[model samples]
Target chain A: MSQVLVVTSGKGGVGKTTTTAALGAAIAVTGQTVVVVDFDVGLRNLDLVMGAERRVVYDLINVVQGIAKLPQALIRDKRIDTLSLLPASQTRDKDALTDDGVARVIKELRAKFDWVICDSPAGIERGATLAMRYADAAIIVTNPEVSSVRDSDRIVGLLDSKTKKAELGERIEKHILITRFDAARAARGEMLNIKDVLDILSLPLLGIIPESEEVLRASNLGTPVTLNDPTSAPARAYCDAACRLLGQDLPMVIPNDRKSIFEKLLGRRAA
Target chain B: MSVLGLFRLRGTAPVARERLHILLSHERSNRGRPDLLAILRDEILAVVAKHVSVDHDQVHVTMDRGQIVSRLEINVELQHPANGPIAAEREKAAMTIVHQASR
Candidate 1:
């Protein structure tokens, strides 16, 4: 059975697109056919992140507006044959994405793809709502901060009340993926701990992607961190999250910022 | 500061949880479930008043959210009119109306 999952966070700059690309790539690596749809109209970046920016000619708007067919707009990744990218139009306005058009495209995508991962734009506007309109499950990307957590809560409320399943009285599956988590800072009481976020959001923890420069490097290189450096901390965490999405019972391991024994000994001696 | 005070440094976590809980509760009340308790109380009172005399303030309606099913508690006091088991009949009638209204 195919499933549509939306990676959404009400606040911007919380790594929703990054999470979508990583998870989509990781899942595709497991031999599952996956397509990541960029739902951020007018500010299309999924194609760039997927390294398919130059390859995108006809986009989601073209398909929705009947200017191009679904197959014509779909960009299949050469690196991973099973993975595809449905890029959004960078020049089109957000109003171009109509409800009926989105429903048609999503229905078609679900017929061919095993996992349709929609990367939602920041905010609770028409674009974001349409992205999540047909989702069977939601991965809420949140940072370990007050404003991010608060906005995530609002999105959770909307998911419970606004989604198609919600309107039909069926519960929509929700998971929390905390992005840019700095364990060292949290240990030093500078940032909120994992437990603090969980307490506020009250959703099952999918995975914690640690704050790392590798994520930026991977994006700049036009490759998802999972495909670029699978051994990196963020990549491993995202892979683990993808496994969890497939119903695997994996223990969440929060990566620690490595400190040498010499530093530990020096601190102890000073104490 | 005392050593205990160091451990008890108030964080924004608890505050966030409290604020979210209050906000969500208000939203649910406004959009989801209506004031069913008040309506049930009025309906039960109207049903019981026909059988036996009762005060307007005699009916009490409360809701307790439990682990399994949320329980709705209703209480009604009946004034005896030279009592010939009229209180019991009125109670049964009120209970029937309440059960029907709930469904």
Candidate 2:
């Protein structure tokens, strides 16, 4: 069965859609058949972020509502052959998504793909809950702030109680992905540190995406940061996260100029 | 020396005290036990009323950060019916009553 991963955060503008596109692209680069689905409904940003907005003729609602078949709704990426996108409907109402219809679509996608990633909408509403209903694992995207962390705590509670795996007494693996991290601000005590966030949330750290202009640029260009600028800080961090998701033993690194210098020195020493 | 005087003299670490206060407040407003004080007050009133005439409105019960348990304070005006007139006893009871209720 395909691993269903939901990229979700309780608070908005915490980089869920961005992370979904970047991670989906990164995973697809490994030649795995991956389809990133947008469950954000009316506010469909994933298709635009993935640079496939024009290609979206039939969307998730179309497939779920039986207006379009799954193959007809799946938008193949021009850049990556292994990657495809199931875009959200811009015209459909959020209430149009029925649980049974969603379940059938997810079941169908799972059988056909290696990785089925769903980009969840923000907040602990029906849209978010449905996106996570059938998830085997979750990427709990959070920002280093009090409100975001509190909202994420509520999301964690829902994940424990509302998921199918949880209902069946099976544990759903959850990882904390802290995005928009500013190291300098954190050092100045402006934002919560990594240790403090981990202490509060008590979930294993996935990877941190630093606040970078590259992310905004990638979004504007309708491409994932990992694909737009593979060597950039945010892209590298996302790629590392994708690798970790694939069960690789990747060393966690703090993205900073000092760390980069240290890496270079260590490389020279080894050479 | 008074117990409170000793606490003041010791000058308990402010950071620890602040953390304790914050944690206590958080626990009080915690999702699991937001109405803990009210529950405790009701239970205490029920228990105390069985033994003596407790002025339920005048009863004071509170939970503070420094204390491990809830504290209950009650001020009662004892009425010796055999030694005094009913009117005098009632007047004394009314005068002895404190206005401040539970925290």
Candidate 3:
């Protein structure tokens, strides 16, 4: 059976979009058919990150409003045959996405794909709520910062109260993905450590994506980091997260940001 | 303490953790019982006032957070009957019996 998962973060700019694309691509690389639906209606950019922007002749709103069919709107990935994208309409606002319309699209996607990942917009408004309305599980993206962690706690409450599972009194499986984590900064007490975030949210840790320039480079080139630079730190972290999502019991690999041996030796000599 | 220790004492992590604790508790209790305690206070007041002259406005109910268990405190002040009337002794005797029988 297919699972509908929402990649969500209450605070903006906390990497909900990046995590969606990377996990979708990583899962697809494992030969699972995955379709990532962009739920950021007015600020649609999942297609750009997935390198399917030019191929988006029709979008989610078009399919929802009956102007286009699902097959016609789904942009199949060129590199990964099993990966696809349902791009959001940049021209339309969130009002264009009706609750019934999203449910229909999600049901259809669930029937066709092994994983249907919804890329939720920031905030707890209609756009974000609708994104998580049909999710069987949620991957909450958070930064190792005070505001992000606090907002994530709010989202956690919503996950318990405002979802269909919540309405039915069923549990929606939740996992926390800490992004933009700087280990050295955390050690210096500049950023919250992973344990601190975990203690506050009390959700299981998914994987930690270290702050890396490779993520910016990948997004700039219209590619997911996992596929763009598979060997990079962020990409490896995302890959591990995707595996964990697939029920693999791999130990989490926390990336270190300590100074290199050469740098430390040079600093000692200079001193 | 060193200056660094002072900064650590006032660090954002500790502050954030404490804030989230209070916020989450308030949120959880609000979600489960936003008006339940008030209704309960009113009901208890109605039952008590039937026998004893109690001030309706004096009924206060509060829930205090505790380590292993939450505490619910209810305070209600009883009013004395006017003019040393016979009804005062009867009401007091009834209240005493009610309290003792419950105990």
DockQ of 2: 0.04
Off by over 4 Å in 3: A256-259, A262-271, B1-11, B32-103
- How would you encode candidate 3's per-residue C-alpha lDDT over A206-233 as one tens digit per residue? 9999998888999999999899878778
- Model 1 alpha-carbon miss at residue A255, Å: 2.4
Superposed on the true chain A, the predicted chain A of model 3 yields a TM-score of 0.95
Highest-DockQ candidate: 3
Tell me the lDDT of candidate 2: 0.81
Q: How do the residues A110-160 of candidate 1 rate in per-residue lDDT, one tens digit apiece? A: 999999999999999989998999999999999988788878988998888
Q: Which digits, one per residue and each the tens of the lDDT, describe model 3 over residues B1-103?
A: 7988876644455666666677665555555445544565567668887887765565556665433344556676554567443344322222110111111
lDDT of 2 by residue, B25-101 (tens): 45434444345555655665676567656545545444443334443343434445456535355312221212222
Clash pairs detected, candidate 3? none
Model 3, global lDDT: 0.85
lDDT of 1 at B34: 69
lDDT of 2 by residue, A87-206 (tens): 998987789888898899999999989999999999878789889999999999998876677777778877888888999999989999999898877775557778777777789999
Superposition error at A215 for model 3 (Å):
1.2
Considering summed lDDT, which 10 consecutive residues are worst modelled in model 3 chain A? A262-271
- lDDT, residue A230, candidate 1: 85
| Fnat of all models, as shown | 0.13, 0.00, 0.27
